[model samples]
Target: MFSERRERLRERCSGAGVDAALVSAPANVRWLTGVPGAEALLLERDRALIAVAHPARDRDEAIEELVVPPGQDPAVAVATAAHAELLGVEEHDLTVARHRAVTDAAHCRLRDLHHAVEQLRVVKDDQELACLRIAAEIADQALGELLESILVGRSERHLAMELERRMVDHGADGPAFPVRVGAGDHSGRARHLPGDRRVEEGDFLTVSLGACYRGYRSSATRTFVVGLAPQDWQVELHGIVFAAQRAARETLAVGTSLDDCARAAGRVLEARGYPPELDEGVGHGVGLDVEEEPRPGALEPWPGEFGKLENRVPVTVGLGVALPGRGGVRIEDTLVVRPSEDGGPELLTITTKELLAL
Candidate 1:
């Protein structure tokens, strides 16, 4: 599968008018090469030369097919010895100092690969989709276990930590992003840092998290009421956010524009008298990185200059209502964009969205 991915990358590089491309981004490297070790691929139209760091005995044996011995600057060594011209590199990831070294070693004009490699990664293959599926399942398992435990008085930070640990225990490479557990005033804030704020009666406890499996990531969020009885406003806000999220998720398909999906949800919020926070977009593409590409929003141009939603592309649909002074609500889910014939969007995160009053 990975060999095929590398071949696709080589074809993409050639089509982009570059003689050769030096993939330096960790995610890009992992995408092209199955070996998770620090490695670089010098891709040309005719051939691809991969250079991986010297590994321990176990890793060395495990990745013998891709290992490039130690004491060798893979990019520099390959560029110099290969006699390749017009080398392309990821300018966004390589620092000025690193770029200088690569250029100093290369005897040709160096150009920026920029988002070319990333653009190639926008559409996922079966292996990538499988990894994301497991990632979402791990997150769902963690969140499900959390719901089964006491949630009346635990600090938000502790809950977040426990969720992360559980994900790791359940076979995740790690937490895709920092676990967010916002309580009371902090609820509804996207990406809220976990804090010492304790869960209290009548308070809204919003938790957003994801787990990384292999190199793919999945994100999910759920808002819960932390008491026996809930405020009427809490119930109403949660329902609004939930409906908006569902609407957005339903809009995901192969040819659907990102702006259309975002607007579908944002308009729902706007109609409810809630000011839309469209800046974050409805969601973003997810794969090797937590947030990858093709952000959905109103300002994003149509026909997506970045890329379009292709079949098997994984993304997160998150929408929230943050009522000032009053606690808010947010609900999100990780889903894969599929052709309408395949039942449309395939949801990876399966935790129930019902507002749970604990």
Candidate 2:
């Protein structure tokens, strides 16, 4: 599987007029070699070599590797052994100092690879999708268990920690990202850090989290009321966001631009008297990293601002609206884009979007 990814990357490099390629981004290296600890990959026309700090911890026998001496840069070590006249490097992954060191180490001109591997990663294989499915399942299991427990009087920080622990308990490597728990006024804010604020009756409680399973990641967010029932206003707000999020999710077809998705969601919110800026963007790609490629933000007029959705590419459709001084609602889910004949978009995060009353 990893070898096939390398062949595709080499094809990308050859198409770009490079004799060899050096992949330094940890995620890209992992994608190419299937070893999370691999730091760099040197890809030549007929050979591939991985560089690592501790080769013994996690080794792939199928690929050759070199253990760099302590305090030495792996990219520089890999570049020093290159056998090509021109090397393509991930410009976004290398720092100026590291790039200069690599330049000095290799007697070859460097060309910017420029997210070539990421573009390759946008469409996932069956194995990759399997890992992502497990990740989403773990996150959903953890969140569901949390909902069944008593949440009143719990601090946001406490809830966040508990969620992370739960994901691990449910067979995840770890939380995909820091678990975000927001209560009352903090609810529905994007990336809201957990705080000392405790949950109260009738308060809105928003929990956003994901799980990392076999290097793949998933994201989901759900909001609930602390009391036995939701207020009329709370119900109304949740309904609006739910409709908006569904609108965005329904737009996840092959060739649908991110802006179109965001606009679809925005229109639903605007029709209900919400601001067009209720959400910065509709969603983003989700894979090895919690958030990866094809990110779409706001309704920018620029053509092809974030590119179009592709089949087999997993993404998150998250939307939220936070009313200042009052609690709000946010709902998000990780889904894989599939053609309608293939069952349309596959929703990985199975947690119910209903505005639950705890």
Candidate 3:
């Protein structure tokens, strides 16, 4: 599997007229090679070298290993190994200091790879999709268990920690991102940092969390009323957000543009009194990283502004709407984009999006 990815990368390098490529981003390193150490990858026409500080801990069986001499920087060691006439580097990720060091160490002209690894990671293979599916399942299971427990007096931080623990207990490597549990007025925000706020009766509660299974991650978010029943406004807001999320998910398809997804969700929110600025439209690509490609496009019209959706690409459709002091609603799910001939988009997070009354 790793070999295939490397070959594709090499093909890209050849097409770009680059003799070799040096990778430094952790996610890119992890994707190309299974081991995600403080390492660098040097890929040539027919050979690959992974320079790390600890050779004994090497977990990537797909490439050769070169341990940096004690005190020598792995980045320099790996960068100097590329002897191609033109070498490619992930300029977006490499720091200026490191870039200078790499330039000094290089024997060839350096060129920006321009997010090549990230571009290649935009689609999902069966193995990657499987890991993402397991990640979503773990996150769903964790949230489900939390809902069944006593939540009236739980602090947001406590709930957040509990959710993280549950994901780990469910066999996840760890939480994909911080487990966020927001109560009171903070509920429904895209990413509310869990605080000391304690759950109170009738308060809105929003839980946003994900699990990392292997190298893949998936996100899930759900909002609920803390009391035995929800207020009329809560119900109304929940319905609106739910509709927005559904519209975004339904709009996802192979060959669909990200703007199509954004416009569909934004229209629903706009029709129902949501400010255009607040319409942070739902959906983003997910894989080795919880949030990867297919983000919102640039303000100015340009090529690749809004990425086009593709089959086997996993993304999340999450919507948030809130009223200060009245709480708000947020619902999200991870799904895979697929063609209609084979099937519609496959929803990975099966947790009910219905507003629950805890």
* Full-model lDDT for every candidate: 0.81, 0.90, 0.85
- RMSD in angstroms, all models? 3.0, 2.2, 2.1
Better of 1 and 2 by lDDT: 2
Order by lDDT, highest first? 2, 3, 1
lDDT of 3 by residue, 37-141 (tens): 648889888888888777645365658888887777676798877778898998888889888899899967899987888888888888889999999999999
TM-score of each: 0.90, 0.95, 0.94
The candidate, 1 or 3, that scores higher on lDDT is 3
The top-ranked prediction according to lDDT is 2
User: What C-alpha lDDT does candidate 2 achieve relative to the native structure?
Assistant: 0.90
lDDT of 3 at 127: 89
Residue 349 lDDT (model 3): 95
**Candidate 1, which ten residues in sequence have the lowest lDDT sum?**
56-65
Give the clash count for model 3.
Answer: 0
Give lDDT: candidate 3, residue 212: 96
Error of 3 at 185 (Å): 0.5
Better of 2 and 3 by lDDT: 2
